[model samples]
Every structure is written in C-alpha cells, then in structure tokens.
Target: MATFNVNDIRNDFPILSEKAYGKPLVYFDNAATSQKPKVVIDALVNYYMHDNANIHRGVHFLSQRASEAFDNVREKVRAFINASSEKEIIFVKGTTEAINLVAATYGRKNIGKGDEILISAMEHHSNIVPWQLLCEEKGAVLKVIPMNDKGELLLDKLNTLLTERTKLVSLVHVSNSLGTINPVKHIISLAHQKGIPVLIDGAQSTAHAPIDVQDLDADFFAFSGHKILGPTGVGCLYGKLPLLEEMPPYQGGGEMISSVTFEKTTYNEVPYKFEAGTPNIADVIALGTAIDYWNNLDRPGAVAWEEELLEYATSKISAIPGVRIIGTAEKKAGVLSFVIEGVNAMDAGMYLDTKGVAVRTGQHCTEPVMLRFGVPGTLRASFMFYNTKEEIDCLMENLGKAIQLLQPQTAL
Candidate 1:
C-alpha cells in the first residue's frame, strides 16, 4: 500500500486552505458534513454549465446527456456498496429521507398492530423518529436495545428483544454522537437467523470505511451523500431487489409512473418507482463524482489515518483535567465527544468558533445519548481522513481556552 499523505489530500479540498476569523481554520465537524473536493465541485459546476436538463423521457441532446449521467450514478452507488444490482439503489434527499422512505413504504405495509420494531438506543433522531411515527400510525410497539455506560450495545439483551413479534430491526451502522462503530454485520446475521430483515443507517459508517451491503445481507441500507464528501439533497436507499419489487412507491409524480390514466395507474420498476418528481440531477451527478473520488483513494490507508486521528484526539482530550469524554466504546470511528467542567457546551462551542476552530456542540441530534450519559450536551470534534494530528492539537488548544474563558463566566 502507498503511504497516505494528509497534506496532499488536503490540497484537493479548497476550503481546507482558507482562513476564518483571521485564523487558520481547524474543521473538526466531519460528522455534520464533509468538505467537498475540487473534483466534486467541478462536477457540479460542469453539470449545470454543460448538461443542464431534466432527466428521463427527453429526446433532446442535453436531456439525454443529463439522463445518462443521472442513471450512471445508480450503477456507481451499486458498485460503491457492492450491491447486487443498480435497480436496488433508490435516490432520496439524504439518510433521513431514505429511512423515512422505508418506514413509510416498507414499515407501513408490513408492520401492523402489536408488531415490534427493534432499534438501538444509540440511533440518531432520523432513525428513531420515522419508526416512532410509523409505530404510532400502525399501532405497533417500538422496542430499544439498551447500551452500557461505555456506549456499547448489550447484544445479550438483543436476543431477548428479537422475539416472534419483532417485524423489523433498524440500527445505526455507527453512532454519530458516541462514534461507536456497531457490529452491524454481526447484528444483521443475528437478525437473519430469526428470519427478520434489518435496516442499517450507514450515514456515519460509509464515509469512514468501505461497505458491502451484500456481505452484511441487510434488507435495506440508507446513507447520506454530504456526510461522504458529496453534495447535500442527495443520498440513496439500497434495498434488496425482491423486497423493492414488492414494496409500494413512497410518492406519486412525473417520473415514477409507468402509465397514468383516469381509471388506473401503474408505477415504474424498483428504483424509479420510489423516485418521484424531478430529481436533484446536478447533485446526484456530482455524487457519482464523489464516489469516483472516494474510489480513487487508498481506502485502507485513509481509514487507518482516521483511526489514528481519533486516537490522537482521544488521548489529548482525555488527559485534560475537569474534562470528561463520553462514549468510551472499544470500537469507534473518528468522533470524540467530550464535556468540560463548569462550561456550557454551546458557550464552549462559541468561544472555539472565534478562534476559527469548528466543532459540533450539543446533543448532536442524539438527545437520547445525552440523556443516557446524564449530560445536557457535549462538544464533539469529529475527524476525517484528510484531517491531521495538527488540527487535533489546534482543537485541544482552543478547547483549553474555551474552558478558561467560560468557566469564569459559569462561576459568575
């Protein structure tokens, strides 16, 4: 394997070189969204500049070009996750929309009164809320698999949770708040043994590592594009071909119809059936470019580098007095969520921002995680492959200043 160079990789991202607040920017909010590379940005610009047209059913030259580009992304996404076929990849707004699509279409259809949907305690709101709404509507029970103080799920309890009444199991591939990389494959295997289908929220996991949906044998997997260095307003849901063929469309509109008449209407095939109205053509095309960018990288090396960043930041933050690190799970990705003594996380976040250090603060959309840990919120410094140990140092430095500045205010 070639040596991974963070500096060279950083050059690909234009925003990494810029200054903010008259200070060199230290962006540690990768869990929120990743910065785009020049290639992806150029792909977006190139599409609008050259291939700007609505896709599918157009005989015009530009429309054909746009249609081909859009369709090609399905193949790219299929290959990216090692799915069996392009027909399984259904594009949506993001992971939120993707999960909601399943809950609405698959959950609504299959789940009924007294049915149980099992989800982990560490799930993001996107994973939790959709199922909650579905359960409310369907008269189904929503069950949770508990986690320990270290933020690791109790798999022993999972066996009890997987009862005959459990209809579907939805879980997060990685905990965004705690950075715990859940053993999704093992969980998926366990669920399959009981003849239960599993849905994985792969938003955080996909950016950190390569994913093989076939190997996991997940019934459905949802991920966001922006979290993986692609543009926002675009992501995909990868469902099994047979399952997708059986499920009803999430919406009705222009592109998703096979034939529409006064009496009856039919929907298109698996993927197109779910995608309605005009798609995010430009971003979807650019997402293909993002996949291309990720594919070109030394993935193993990149993942290792991110792990190193996580370790380096963890050590630095953990050594500080009066600061407590949350989510000390044995297996984790590139996230370090911590709380400082006598400091409001939001205030700490603001103080750090003035120094041009960008870190996510608060519950991070994981309110249950905060409540479980007995904290209002945390200051999270999430890393990516392009990030350096130097940036971690900058975060630690600014964090100390934030504590000093805010602790006094807390006393007052």
Candidate 2:
C-alpha cells in the first residue's frame, strides 16, 4: 500500500506529469472525469494483448480466461461497495444508464398514474431527465426538495414531500457542481420509513469516500468508473436482491436470457437480467484494477489532504476581487465552483487552459442548480487526492490574470 503523499500518488497517474501547452498540467476537472491511473491503463492493454475474447459465451481458452477476468470484477465491485451479494451488482455503461434502468424497470412496474417521484434540486440532468420521462409516461408527478442558498437541501421539508403517493426517492450523494455532500443516509432512512425505496446517484461521492450499501441501507446505488480513476464506458449499479428480482429487465438481448423459443423467451436471473448485449469487456477488467489501486492507498490520509486542498484553494480564490464563490455549503467535498463578476465563465475557462490549468465551465449537467443559483453557468475546479496546494496557487495566479484580461474596463 502506498502512503497518501500527494507527489507519490501523483506519479501513479501518467497524465499528471505530462505537459499541456508547453506548461505543466494542473488538472482540476475531476468532477467531469478523473484521469486514469497507469495500473488501470496497463490492465486495459494487458487484456487486449493477451485475453481478447468475448465473455460468458465462448468455450475456448481465451474466452474462459476473459470470462473469469470479467466475472471477477463483479465480485470486486460487490466487495468495493460492500454489497450483500455479487448478484446485486449489475454492470451498465455508467450512472446515467443505471438510473434509467431503474426508471424503466422498477418504476414502470411499481409507479402508476398520479404517483409522485421525489428528487432534490441539485441533481444532474442524468438523474432529473429519466424521472421526468417516467413521470410523463405514467402520468406521475415529479416533486423536488428545495435547497437553501448554501446548496443544502432543506431536510425539514422531506416529511411533507414523502407522501402516500410518493413511489421513490432518488438523490445525488454529492452535488457535482455545488460540492455539497448530501445526507443521503438520513434521506434513505426517511424514505424507507414511508416504505418508499431510495436510489442514490453516487457518481461524485464514490471516489472521494468509502461506500457500504449495507451500512447506508440504500435500495439502489449507481456510480461511474471514469469518475473513479478507471477506464470510461463501464460502471456499476448495486440493487437489493429482492427489488432486482421483482423488476423487469431493462433491455432484451443475449446474456440476459435463459432460454428462447420462437414464441417466448425465459429471462435470466437478477443481475444478468439487467445486462444486455455485449458488455464493455476490457474496460470492466480495467475498472477492477482501479478498485485495486483505491484499496491499496491510504484512503483516510488522501481524504484529509483533499480537504486541505479545497480549503486552501477556497480561501485564496475568495480573497480576490471580482470573484464570487458559488455553492457555499458548510460541508463540501472536492469541488470549487465560482463566477467572475465581469468575465464570462467560458472565456475564463479557455484563458485558464492556455496557462495549463484545466477546469470545466458550463452548467455542469446541473441546469436546475444553475437556475436555483441564478447563474448562467460557473467555472468549476474540482480536485482529487493526488492534487496539491501548489497546483491551487497556480490556479489562483492564472485566474487573476484571466479576470483582468476579460473583465470590462470601467468608465474612465
């Protein structure tokens, strides 16, 4: 296991050492997608080089090897999140598909006309749109839990929202744009009390903190691999065994079937039922390597260092003129979103890029959050454990220059 020294951890990610525009790269766009670790990259290469075969179907030696490697990742995901069984873990493209799977399957089964689905205000479009589609299809209503100016959900309003007609509560564990760490466990308990199942969108939270589905008592949880230092196009959805069994399959295809006649086909059991067609074979194995890298790190130390980075960056940036920090939650994770008074966010972002600082500037797929905060968009600088306070200094220096360059000259 490697100690959580930022420099040592930084070395494991090759991109961190690369030059961007002839300057050292300072990657603060982790919330959009994390940089891949070398071990994860190696795993992808090794699989393609030696074990390139379709999984779970072929009887050849390469197929057997690939199948074993693929199936082993399911178990790793089960243990990674402490899911009750490997049968509860289903592989999807990413969190968006995972939420859609539930909305299409369990929602269509249980939800009815006039029923309600509760969600928070600070949801990514991925979380919001699927529920809207389900509601529109079923004549159901979508209810939102409002957040305060600080981006904290008003939990006091939850009881009123979780009514008899409420079918499910889907919440984001962390705000991708706001950096707020939501109390999803408490929200889950509240939903469970009303016999409403809860699904947590854990895309941002999974990489920053430890997850135990059993401990959280979450009915379903979804997260992406790319957000956790793994390869893209693969992710996990953890559902309770009973709920998954009761729900219908999201799609119809090869692996999700048991037997097929010309007239009717028998579906496979639980997790397999949700996985349709050929899966992302190489990326899934590479995600397992990502889990291994996470498990072997000083996680607690890394978390503390990230906190320090956020704090230092926040204080430094807040002190500058024309800077208005958005998402001022008392409890935030690795995100720092703000808007300059006179400069457009996109212009600022591009200016930062020329200085070798990569940040995201847009709605961040959380248009509702932007609407709530009354901003068109924001410049979001999200951090990770491997990031350093020195890198933050570079962000502040470059941002100061961007503001001066883009800000309109006042009436002289």
Which candidate number has the best TM-score?
2
Q: Candidate 1 at 178: error in angstroms? A: 0.2
The lDDT values for all models are 0.94, 0.95
Candidate 2 segments whose C-alpha is farther than 4 A from its true place: none
lDDT of 2 by residue, 1-412 (tens): 6667888888889999989999999999999999998999999999999999999989999999999999999999999999989999999999999999999999999999999999999999999999999999999999999999999999999989999999999999999999999999899999999999999999999988999999999999999999999998999999999999999999999999999999999999989999989999999999999999999999999899999999999999989998988899998999999999989999999999999999999999999899999999999999999899899999999999998999999999
- TM-score: model 1 vs. ground truth: 0.98
In candidate 1, residue 250 scores what lDDT?
98
Q: Give the count of colliding residue pairs in each prediction.
A: 0, 0
* Model 2 lDDT, full chain set: 0.95
lDDT of 1 by residue, 77-153 (tens): 99999999999999999999999999999998999999999999999999999999999999999999999999999
